[model samples]
Target: MATPQPRRWIPYPPLISVCASLWWLSAAAASVHEFPTDGTVIELDDASFERAISAFDLILVDFYAPWCGHCKRLAPELDKAAQVLAQLNDPITIAKINADKYTKHAAKYEIDGYPTMKLFMHGVPMEYTGPRNAELLVRFLKKFVAPDISFLESDSAVQNFIDMAGANFPVFIGFGLNESVILELAHEYKKKAWFSVAKDFSEEIMVAYDFDKVPALVSLHPKYNEQSVFYGPFEGEFLEDFIRQNQLPLTVPINSETLKLVKDDERKIVLTIVEDELDENSLKLVRILRSAATANRDLIFGYVGVKQWGEFVDAFDISKRSKLPKLLVWDGKEEYHIVVGSEYLDDNDQGSQISRFLEEYREGKTIKREMDGPSLIGFINSLISIRTVYLIVFIVAVLMVIQNFSQTEENPQFRGIQDGAEGTDASTSHIESCRDYQPVNKED
Candidate 1:
């Protein structure tokens, strides 16, 4: 009929159809997901999990257990984060599932530990290894909702981008540079860092980021109050290497989340084990570690708190009896080195101790030791410390010995036999003979 009606031709039927299809798609997209406006962590179960994941463009789901202390600590932070994130134009949903209760769902996602976070973007899942503090977590999650490479037309836009980027993740801004230059990197490292191009920015902005050249790419670690500028050669591995190295701050705190970052890095870790990472002494030591890290950019300087993660500390053979603020160079695997002379750091001379340790490490003057046990499993399942495990074994052995002795005493024949064996001088004679016999050295 349309062909026959060609004489009364309908102009641009395809264009009309395409316009109608686009309108339908836009409506469908709007209807497919209705983001929550409540700004509270949505409690999810097996039944609603899939629906929720498909309903939001970006969602951070915490796979948690009811009795998990870490999960409990994370709840309030998540709550605060939900409130802040919900207000964004493209809201990010914060949700949790009791992995313990919903074993099927947990197994599907490979959630082996408590409070494991996974971010779902358009139905694809990736592990969420960002900061846990409420404000920092908000900043970290914002990266997902942001454009891969933001184009800033004005200086005000640059300032707004930086202010909005926050301090959780490093931000890269290309000044007087083209988007095509950093496009690939922006997409590659988008999850770990923020990347943008400042189309219009003044020298004052350059001074703020500590760069003096045009067509410069500046990397900012606002959390650590650090910034570095790279001039040109932004085509290949050189640009990537610079960006990769700067993903983490000069010194990173070793935790479950940050540990993921450290593991991905090729550099060895200059690990400092402290009594409490939040304590004043530990903070001061972290600053020293940062200085060392600055000097030796090839190595990652990290610190973990014994109080915060005792099992991890135990893996390094550190205990309450051991010296405080222990320094070791970890290969980020099973083996680590303790400098022979500078094994333990003195609180008074921590800076010197760290310098000496690093010096000895470079000079190959250190003792290499395997971690006490498999640290990942130990971190998750070791509710009690290694010392506690030993103590329990000791107590059980002592109790078994006492019970065996009581049983032997109750058995008259066994007691008489034991007494006879104890009274025998034959055992004593054998011991004396063995002591008198010297071990003969054999010729190779």
Candidate 2:
């Protein structure tokens, strides 16, 4: 009888099973991510790169070469930004991999240039085209982590939101409007601009933003001190178009980054080429361009300085010998148009000159010309300049001349024939050189 009772075994307690399940969940969560949280820049190799990408919700990876000057400059800035970001409740990791050493990974990411910053969000890679400075970089990266559309319930909340948004991105505040109105656009353009809804705000807020009505969407370009208000009809493409156009400032400084932004835009660029963008005169001219841009939102007004980006300026057939402050309307591609009468701005009255230039551009009184050299290949951080192309051609011509001279020395009859056909052959070679290097006038 005792042996039969012993055969009936007892079950484990229910609490034990509950405890076991909790333990398993905790272990799984820890195993999901073992990333460093000490604000240090994670140096990733091919082995750990995939693990890091999967571990962090948001991470910025800099694909860089050790020998690259730009990469060197970016390192300290990244280090500082990493420290600041680490203090956040939801931190973003800054990482770098030597693209030069990791050939396989570099090729995989199509890392054609050094210091290529890519932000990986939930295993999806997006090119990081934000500012490089530590402070601005932090503000820029914060955009990614921010809510699709922040809801402001108070005036101070609205002001604080604006202050924290920084001047790097355009801020769109929907005053007295429903979240559903801007929810879609907020998600669509989250990366390019900041979107928000002010649930409770007074006329002070309205007047400050220069809007007199409720249900008004205000787009603020803080960096440019510009604000534009949109009153409804915000259902379809009108809302989207307004957001798209206002993403850029009234006048954009034409640089590698800004150029990339304008490339896909349908509007032609009213480009002002100056000697030095940082100069007093150039800055004054930019103000005038901004005013014109405000009035003519259909066209994009941009300026480039020869001192800053000589190659890009040269692409427009501009040189130091040419007049400064040259104005043209570019198709944002291979061709640009110059008003025949207003090719250059007057030093005495730049504002009037710019107005006339815009008028001429609108009236189709302009000459279209192709960009010099190749079709803007690799315009971002271009290694080969127009001058470099010209030098290579010049070298080739010199080598050809040397070869011909050597051939003539060996063959006396060939030299005699060459001399006899001098005018015809010389003219042909000269014309060919001009054709190769000169800007093609499409208007011709």
Candidate 3:
């Protein structure tokens, strides 16, 4: 009984060491998976979301869900965009967050759908509604990353750019002056056109266009061999007006070109039906329309020389006996005289007549006939044209209509598919739960 038992120590099991090693390896793999290995796109999460977004001048974020089919399809487009954008002079950062895993980030940006792409510029976020193609993405990203204005001081720089540009885009060159304001236009129309500033003009450049001043704008369409010259006080609103006016044709003729212009334009077309193509009065009408056009870019100014095209005059119902230069407007659906009666056509106050016409149109005083507005079929076609937004609206509207029809008098208070959604109290618990993560403004 007194025999002391030899002290025994249980040998440590091998499984303990093996289990610890597996746990360590798992953690290492998780850390690696948390970040994107490729440099094209950055992986963001709740912790680094704000800082990462704020670091870039312009960053496009893809709020995606793993199980979403649309999200999976958009992944390749986003990766392609990221790679292409990576090569820009000033690159735009393309990043993504797994909204399904990071529900907080999804809630922050109000992500109700998968693959929601937003362009955040200097902390201000704008939803991207453009096409989801590589070409459109490149063009769209260039809007945020492009230089405001490129200066071409030497003839070689100007010539090289113009010649090498392949005449695919319109080239706007400001000669003999370097105004900072042009940069504003450059930013606005960067995606639509190319802009450059030249402090001095070469003899060849000046000889091509008839401009004598320093602040002259030359709109060159190399493909069409067309050039529009504008000389002006190029510093303020006037400069902006000049740029806007030159961006489109001053007066579009009514024919094949007119059909394309009208079909493409969603705005009301202010058309002057002239009996003569080169008539002085017809030209005056065009000039007046141009003056009006300079202010209201929403309205397109065009002239139909109906003398040769009598069928068009009948189609628009323009009276030949009324006046040589009769003014009427087409809503891209039906044509109506600018003035209800023909008296205003020859009025000495031509500007006032046009102004009155526009004012009446804007104030809803101008009556829109069944023909003046889109027909039922045309309206349906137009609805389809705005597919993404209007399609959703149309579906919702149809559902509401069906739901209303399905409801009976017995349950008059029935609230269809939306049921308690509308006018229901939204819980503030989410806000309360997220309060800790919210950034507090120091001033508050």
lDDT winner = 2
lDDT for predicted candidate 2 compared with the true structure: 0.86
State, as a TM-score between 0 and 1, how close model 3 is to the true structure: 0.48
lDDT of 2 at 225: 88
Per-residue lDDT tens digits for candidate 2, residues 7-32, read 66677799789999999988756744
Which regions of candidate 1 fall more than 4 Å away from where they truly are?
A: 1-48, 64-87, 95-98, 131-137, 274-285, 305-310, 320-326, 342-356, 374-378, 382-444
TM-score per candidate: 0.71, 0.79, 0.48
Q: In candidate 2, what residue range of length 10 has the lowest lDDT sum?
A: 378-387
Cα RMSD for predicted model 1: 12.8
- Candidate 1 per-residue lDDT, tens place, 1-444, comes to 445533676679899999999999887676444445589788888988987888788889999888878889999999999999999989898999998898788889877677789999987999887789999888888788888999998879998998999987899999999999899889988888899999887778877778888889988998778887889698898999889889988888887667778988999998888889999878888888888887898899888998898877888988679887788889887899988768788857778878888888999998889988655566645333343456778999999999998987789997677768877686687789999998777873
Cα lDDT tens digits, model 3, 1-444, are 699889898867798899999999897676544544344789888887887666666788898878778788888888888877877777777889988788897787777666778988877887775557776677656756546667887878888667644443567888876657577788887755678888765777787666665667888766546567777777788777656655456566666434653655566677777787667777677777767876787777777786766655555544656565666667766545445653246648788877777777666555343332222343343223232456688899999988877766347566353345543333354455677686879899
RMSD in Å for all candidates: 12.8, 10.7, 18.1
Candidate 1 C-alpha error for residue 357, in Å: 3.9
Candidate 2, residue 170: the lDDT equals: 95
Best model number under TM-score: 2
Number of the candidate with higher TM-score, 1 or 2: 2
